[model samples]
Target: MSLPRYQEYKNSGVAWLGNIPRHWEAVFLKRVIKAIDSGVSVNSIDTPAEENELGVLKTSCVYRGEFDPSENKAVIPEEHDRLACPVRAGTVIVSRMNTPELVGAAGVVRQNIDNLFLPDRLWQVHFKDAVPAYVHYWCQTPIYRAQVQSACAGTSSSMQNLSQDEFRRFVLALPPIREQSAIATFLDRETAKIDGLIAQQEKLIALLAEKRQATISHAITKGLNPAAPMKDSGVAWLGEVPAHWRVGKIQNFAKRESGHTPSRQHPEWWENCTIPWFTLADVWQLRTDNVKFVYETKELVSELGLANSSARLLPAGTVMLSRTASVGYSAIMGCDMATTQDFINWVCKPELTSDFLLYVLRGMRTEFDRLMMGSTHQTIYMPDVAKLMMGLPPIEEQAFIVSFLDTEITRLDALTAEATRGIALLKERRSALISAAVTGKIDVRLS
Candidate 1:
């Protein structure tokens, strides 16, 4: 798959561009661009659907390599005139402000678009000679990105801004117009092939997740033997269970508890904290890698903070379910921890297994979401969760179910991990290929 190289090379006198094709010219962007315009600052926030005439492009609109109309922030009709001229097909756009990793992301509109205004944080330019797609691809190169990143600064840690003056003076390594068109066409074909492969891997990961969920849901609800006798559990969501299994409310099996946060005003309350303070942030950690054990948390509270607040300290193996904001995510505490009110935890009785309760709750995530919606709620209340009914099996059967799931899920996890790695490698190759072709390390003009 190696491509041919140009016959001759010459030094470009730029750090990022050690050498280029002898025929190519390295010049300032200001010399080749007909005009560079920045969008107006529209101090407005409204839903996209509410404004039909036009919307303002969010700084994120061009944050990636492609034009994303969905990232637009809706603006009122009165603000439409703020843009000097509406964006058109084949216009090169760049982000003037973003994190170092994403600053200077550029894309070209592929079609004639209407009713979309640009934000002040973006730059729109028309090339006097070079192709828009060629410049767009240039902006994605590591050398160009590194140059932009070196010039950007931020008032706050989260913000990085590229000034217009610095951008205008930036130099570009350019090919003749005909060569630019050929390179752009070649990249469009090659990257699309790579993107298709990445999409297939993504589909595989999704299918594995679906199969895993179904396996867990069936094992927990239907018991180990499919042919076992069945009986109605009286829970509408859960139709029936094994005849020998018992059905009971969540409260019947465990004691429900909540948590609280200490005031931020008291710095002394949090100083040199030693006790594990669990909050909603732990739910995200669990979602990241399907993390099951909360062996550690992002923050810890001092004994003073815990004593000053209503936070309750619970032992290891307690099952915690989110009840506010991002509801339904659950995790088991791997160690004794104090928590915030965003969660409703369960301390299982000796007769009932904590592993069994955790499975039942995890299986009920979808049901929790459904119930949360039925109540028209942004958060699930404690009373509604307390009433959730689950089918219970003997302690031996509970242990068997957990063991079987652990083995089967681990096997599927391996397959999923392989697919994830495949996607990552494909992405790395795509970036490298683009950088090599656009920077003239390889010649892409031939079929």
Candidate 2:
């Protein structure tokens, strides 16, 4: 699509912002604004210290365009006296040392607290004459964020930071203060409305998910016979269940087994393995329609041991449960697949349907955590999971439960997806409005 002629002239060649007003001039950030390190470090702040003094601003407290004082830490003792670069109201503080995506998160200091100090990892900018709010919004744009990401340098898990000198070199278009204020006001109102819509959609999605879970849990445990006599299950989360249901160990109806990892150093053994290897990342999505890689049967037989075989492919009806990290997530194997030692595969007995067992496992997710062991990372051992007590019903009733839940939950999922899409469209409209207003494509200035 062709851009308007005016947009063509102002195009700094940055795709996110097509063009600017003909009267405006684009310049390096260093030429327009002064960057200050505000060398007040907050490393030694004592938590138990007096609350009367101004709290230190940590990198985390400044996000987007607001100061979250609730997350601020106490000022360190030695650096308290050196707090000369105290950030006053209207100063824009940008995070210099965060993840690439989070770097350059700009927040405006709209209010002042006594003795407030900015941390070393942040850059405080004082605009020569441009609106601070305008600078904040510009920094948040996609074009500016791309520049910040390119400026970052680091190899570790955490992205390294950019210096004050690097930030000063950032290039952006400048408009008059009157125009800047008009742009800021237009964005403030439009973005708020967009955010409100997104929030409402998010809340609706959460409600739908909750309803879906409750519906499945109710059907699997209580059965379709609503008139059945109910009895107290003795669990607070699960109040009362059908009186006829029998409470017993999960191991009674299913076999609980763990998996193992083959040595990666042996290229000969690892190569051509027909067995499909599964990891934590595989279980990230509830639906198992895709996998990263697969192994050959010959490699599995020649070099893989029984423990490595712990990841042996189970039948299509098998139920898999994550035992670490994102604990308690469960899914029924749509096809045969092997998993890591971090997972426990529950193969249902002939008496129980795998679909019914999947729902049962979902209901028992909380109980699984209660039986977990280990200090740092909680885990459910084979014995702990095998011995889990559960209430079971007749086979015929189990089939009824699965069929009823399948139809109801699908409807709820559809509604949630529609709501999510609506929110996304609203956000797109909000961004387009901001870009148009700032670039003078849509004039917000009153004559």
Candidate 3:
């Protein structure tokens, strides 16, 4: 679908839609709309207790081009005489103090509730010739948002705001009132359909993730033998383990060890280190395919006291468990790297397969957290790690289970990625639709 081209004029370095119908005109926001400061103050007074007056709209109440009344904060008292930002049902509200990305978040007020107060952080827009809903959708477009962001100023923590006067100076292309209403109605139906489709894709993605996890957990705990007798594994999470499987400490197959960081004061040690040093942040995602930095061999051996330690390069199949901050997260090592003290490396023995052990450890993370020590900083001590009992199968069975899970999970991941991409495309299309309709690229006037 190609958009119709029209003559354009630049305002504050932004192009405005021109060559519009003779009746249409490009006007400054101040000229077409009035920004009123409804001084119904909430910070100075106490909140009311009545259920009817229990809701007050804050900046967060408006999000993603809609007003979420459920997110409203406090209610206004009946005695409050000050007219809280009085906006009609169709008025547009834009957030003034949000981050640059969210600075100009705009939504139309679809319904009117009595005594609803708009916090000072939000700016209410009342359009003259154009429908408020149409303008609201226009402001949500990427082009307009970039303009708003460029006009804003402030530090990173708190974004600078646009005063009513500055907001009035904003230039906008205005179609006839009937055209504006027609465009808004068209967008309301089209965007709602797109949103519904995106939501369905999101649910499918979640279902795929859950199914993948269940498949991995089942294969690791139970052998491939369909007729194997099941026995209670004592732990509620490990309900029925294969009767032939043995439960023993992880230390039986692998050893527990901590990592050390070379002194930062001596930059030389870190400068030449070729060994990959991983911190807690590095373990945030499930896959660590791309490591950011590497450490020198000399620094790894001398400054880091890893000479005898050798940074535990347990082949490509090692399973790693995170033990701090974001605890209980586990992933199979895609490559060999040295992890910080915040991890308990599970080096699988010759009797165990790496992929099989990875799945088992991933399933056992919750149990590991329950056994973790330290009140101030949650940690899984080596002793606690040594006490964990796991059910293991023979080496050949482990390989079979790993191969089955690998094939199944790979399919699930592909489906999940496709659904995610579809959702993203829908969102982009919705934005483009809104931008085109409001900018007069599409004719909304009915014959």
Candidate 4:
């Protein structure tokens, strides 16, 4: 997939665009025949506008050099007068104010939009001489991103502002009109092939995850021997279980404990921290790293902090379930630790093991979704958690199930990791292809 370089080249005097085809021209953005117009901010609802209604664009409308008209909100009738910058074809929409990484993102529209208006954080560039698609692709290159990063302004690092003057000063290496169209067409075709491969890998990853969850649910609900006699478990989610398995409330087999945070106002309580503290911050380890046991925590609490607060130093092997904010994630504690109020801890009795309980919790994702409450922040209240039930297998069977699941999960995780790596490589190739084509690093006229 390599293309031939141009016959002759010359330095453009710009660091990003080191060398260009002899016939190509490199010029500041303002030199092109165009006028940049910005839009005014308006009050709008979160819902997108209907075909007959007017809408105001959101900062998310442009991503990765692509335009999404649907990423806009419905504008009420009163704010229609403030909507001056109407979305039009043959123009580029650039985000003028956003987070540092996305401040100068731009996209080109392929068709004339009727009722969509830009917001104050966006600017519309109407090109008179340059090809809109070429300019859009150029905006995605690292060259444009570096320049935008250097020229960005704002008091805070999270949100950056890009001025029209600074944006216009961006320089691009341009080819003739026919060559520009050819390059854009070449990218559209080649990138589509790469995108299709990436999509297949993503779908494979999703299917592997579903299979992993199903495997866990099946092993925990039914015994390894399919011929084992079955009986009604009484619970709707736990339809039936092995005849010999014991069925009862979850609280009967384990002691349910809640977590608490130390008072921030007491400065002395926070000093000289030693004990490991499990809080919502450490849930990311379970969510992404796919680890079954939590050995370390992001923060630690002092003995004074534990004494002053309602927190308790639970022993190793305690099962921790995040009950609020980020709910449903569970793991076994690898060492003695205290926790914040965000988790629901459990100490299994002699009849149940912590590893077995961890599997049961993971298998009950549907039940978690059903019992969770609240609009903005969902939580599994103590009362609902107390009423939960499970089918208890024999100790030997519980140990066997844990061992079988550990093996299966390891295989699935390896497959998922491979697919994820494939996606990363595809994205890198896409970015490199776009950068090389837009900057004349590789001649794409005949690609």
TM-score of each: 0.92, 0.83, 0.80, 0.96
Candidate number with the higher TM-score (2 or 4): 4
Q: Order of all candidates by TM-score, from best down to worst?
A: 4, 1, 2, 3
Expressed as tens digits, the lDDT of each residue in 1-447 for candidate 4 is: 898788899999887678988899889998774888788989999899999999999989996568899999999899887788889998999998889988999999999898999898999898867889988888888899988998985446999888888988889998988899999899889888999999999999999999998998888888788999999998998888999999998789999888999999998888999999988889887575368898899898999999988879999999988889888889999999988988988999999999999999898889999999998899999898889898899899999999999999999999999999999999999999989898787888866
Error of 2 at 173 (Å): 2.5
| lDDT, residue 86, candidate 3 | 52
Which candidate achieves the best lDDT against the true structure? 4
**Each prediction's whole-model lDDT (CA):** 0.82, 0.69, 0.67, 0.89
Model 3 poorest ten-residue lDDT run: 289-298
Model 2, residue 169: distance off in Å is: 2.7
Give the TM-score comparing model 3 with the true structure, all chains together.
0.80
Cα deviation at 429, candidate 4, in Å, is: 0.9
**Total backbone clashes of candidate 3, pairs 3 or more residues apart or in separate chains:** 6
Best model number under TM-score: 4
Across residues 221-293, which tens digit of lDDT does each residue of candidate 1 receive?
A: 8988988999998987667889999898987889888899999999999899998988777768656436677
Model 3 misplaced stretches (Cα beyond 4 Å)? 1-19, 36-59, 72-88, 113-120, 153-160, 260-271, 287-302, 305-317, 364-388, 445-447
Candidate 2: tens digits of C-alpha lDDT, residues 1-447: 122323435565655555767777677887768546564565555452355765667777676445565556666666577665666777788887787667778877777655566777777778777788877777766667777876775534476687777788887777788888877886787688788888999999899878877787777667788799999877554568899887666778888767666667665656555655567666565432121112222124223533444456666667778887767777776656666787887788877777777777777655766877777887777776666666778888888787787778778878987997998898678767655665556656652
Distance from true location, Cα of 158 in model 2, Å: 5.9
